[model samples]
Target: MISKRHADILKILDSSGTVTVAELANLLGVSTETVRRDLRPLVEDGAVHRMHGAVSLTGPTAEAPFRRRMRENAPAKQAIAARVAATILDGQTVMLDTGTTTSFIARALTGHRRLRVVTNSMDVARTLAVTGGNRVFLTAGEVRPDSGAALGPAAVAHVLQFRADVAVISAGGVDALAVTDYDPDEAEFARALLTCAPRRVVATDATKFGRRGLVAVVGFDGMDELVTDAAPPAVIASAMAAGGARLVLAG
Candidate 1:
């Protein structure tokens, strides 16, 4: 499903460099009532820039394009990416998921001499291809235009054929028992990916720390490690740790 918020954010960023509530409403074909509701959290989270009557991403008034939203918090995401990169050992068969955070890790891994990366994300695959010298494995299936990852039953079956040393996935949110995502196909595809990889690592930022998105990709008990920008809510973090999952705060 195409979320109105997602569609609006991406649309506004694409047409105008940055936009205000009024401008966004016009660009996104929505009402000011709906525009303000969508812009509130994005502005607060620093994902978008806001001003009296205009908004943009480059300057104080600019907002990040949807595709680059997660890259905005360089310090926090780099901290998280560093730890994720450190976890990769030479010659390990790793599974990388789609997300800005994971994409950062893919670029950070320049030192690893020998390793195979199996991923459904075109961006991650292309980024790693730049660093040079690693076996990059792309799964077989249809790509999802909405989420920027490979999906469909064929993709799930292809992932099941291999056992990864570690699978690093990005989440839209984290709840008590499950990982969350905006789209059901992406969530289901993620579930199948996790089942194929015995050791699972979740790569998410502080913004996704406690929210529950549309679907549960997997539960806390299913993870081997949870890597984030900050310490997750103590109670939830502890519960995850108790499940034998290591909870590491990068930022």
Candidate 2:
């Protein structure tokens, strides 16, 4: 029988690829010995792998597809979303690009009323459209089956039609040079959305720190703020300082 504690451990591993045993013990409010006892059966069954002082998911369960990315670093993404949502007021217009972090942001904004949302993510649209007395404009474009994001020229043109109070985007990577994306169409669409808002915010998790993606979305100079779960590397921090973009660390 899987105890509730066992289930909680799996959930944590699903969100964070690896975690120290001490961290898990702290999170579960148990002693290290207890955690070890709970992990024994799970390890024996090959549901999780044990490192010297940490644990991680095993085999195919560790793979991160788009849907899996939604689960990855979930707590960090949620914290980032909460920080971004705190800056947005009710009845404000928000522009968002498609990405897993932005999808988290959409859920965070559900409490706000009368929000005008413009987005190219079907997930974002579906999340905010039904609740909050908000009006959501979903762009028409070539929808990627993997992410349910509308991309390409049509999406860019659709986003260009509206100006917003704020634009929140997600990144595949954030290095010293720029914020970047894995897909060219996603990058192009994000660039267009950035132009539509005076306050452009990039929300990414700590795992993206120092990674370089295939396509450049924008340099720090192009954005007003960068929000993440942890402090960036010194080089990336220096670049953001040089570019005059505020760095917001999510609590």
lDDT of each: 0.73, 0.89
Write down the TM-score of every candidate.
0.72, 0.76
Model 1 ranges off by over 4 Å: 1-66, 130-132
Q: How close is each model in CA RMSD to the real structure?
A: 8.3, 9.2
lDDT (Cα, tens digit) per residue for candidate 2, span 77-189? 99999999999999999999999999999999999999999999999999999997999999989998767999999999989999999999999788899998767899999
lDDT tens digits, residues 6-101, model 1?
656855675545344555666677787877777676668766665444455533444334454544566777888898888788888888877777
* Runs in model 2 lying further than 4 Å from the true structure: 1-64
